[model samples]
Target: MRRSFRVLLCLAATAVGLTTLSAPANAAAHNYVALGDSYSSGVGTGGTYSGGGCKRSTNAYPQLWANTHAPASFNFAACSGATTTDVLNSQLGSLTARTTLVTISIGGNDAGFVDVITTCTLGSDSTCVNRVEQGKTFARNTLPARLDNVYSAIRQRSPSARVVVLGYPRFYKVPGSCNVGLSDTKRSAINSGADVLAQVTAQRAAAAGFTFVDIRGAWTGHEICSGDWWLNSLTWPVEESYHPNKNGQARGYLPALNAVTG
Candidate 1:
């Protein structure tokens, strides 16, 4: 009887060890998908990826977020010029039951960020201001609905996955002594629009039962004119303009990190 009992104990321990070893192998087969725009794609920040040209970068924020927090089986579907709708119709097809995480940073392009830049560089004063205000309205009104659709589709596709909605950082600084070509009134208008955008995104996050990672606060002192700005100034030193650089991407990661794990 003692010998029989010893044999049974050994069999049970072997079974447990096999289960433990297989668990990681099973998990390794799962997936994670990242969906968003250039901010998520890591353009201009460096770290080129194969096959994506400049649209996708290995060092982008979502990839950074994934490296820091995601499961091992994740794929970044972020493109530089992707709009909110692009995420739902294209990026989401990559997800399956094995998918476990989805992170997004969108709505900027849909709100006419491209037009803002293009029109500003070429248009006259009235045309620029008018275009900016028009874009602001679109961002405030149309973007939330687009975000809602994308968020909902992601939830439907990957029911068990963790979703993260990342907010945009403050682009312009508050009015101060060092006013660049852009006026304080214009800056205030832009900031107000951005604030509204953040608010709506937060609301969408709550509705979808996902985490809303606010990048604005972490970017407070890192605006364009600050000595240690995360993003480069839009008006000068041409190589760095209108987007987050390495410092900005690095700084932006903190809020995302705090949101997912905290």
Candidate 2:
């Protein structure tokens, strides 16, 4: 009877070891799909995958996360210039029942972000302020409903996946003393617009039962003109302006997403 008991104990210990060994394989098998706009696509991070028109960079947060985690499948479907409607039409196909993780940073385009920035950078201060206000109004009023639809679509497409909605960071550091061409007043206005965008995004994300990753605080002291700026200033390719640099992806956005996804 003693010998039989020892054999049984050995068998149980072996079984436990096998299970432990297999756990990593199971984790590595999860499907992760990234869906969003230019930020997620790594517009300013400066590298591109062939033939997506989305300008996806190898250093983008989603790619960075995937490289570290080694998910069984990784899909980058985020696009440059993608609005909420563009996502609904073009990006949703990437999600499926097998998807285990989804990360997105959108709604900037929907809020007329480019228009506001253009006005702020080139137009008069008063015009910049007025356009920024218009963008803010849209963010507060119309953006929520649009966000809900996209969130709902994601839920329907990937019922069991964990969805994380990442908010945009302010382009300027607070107390707005940046020398990035735009005046301090315009910088403040842009920062305020970022705040509104984050607020509305967080609300909608919660309402849809998704996690909202607020990047505002993480990006503090790392705006366009800061010594350790993670975002690009007005660059040669204009499109890269105001977008996160490679450091922002590797440091700023990557850690934020990891905290939630982990």
Point to the candidate with the largest lDDT: 2
lDDT (10s digit) by residue, model 2, range 6-73:
99999999999998888743548779999999999999987555436788888889889989999999
The TM-score of candidate 2 is 0.91
Q: What C-alpha lDDT, on a 0 to 100 scale, does residue 110 get in candidate 2?
A: 95
Q: Which prediction has the highest TM-score against the true structure?
A: 2
Each model's TM-score, in the order given? 0.79, 0.91
Name the regions of candidate 2 deviating beyond 4 angstroms. Answer: 1-27, 176-178
Write down the TM-score for model 1. Answer: 0.79
Tell how far residue 110 is off in model 2, in angstroms: 0.3
lDDT of 1 by residue, 151-188 (tens): 88888888988787888877777754464566665556
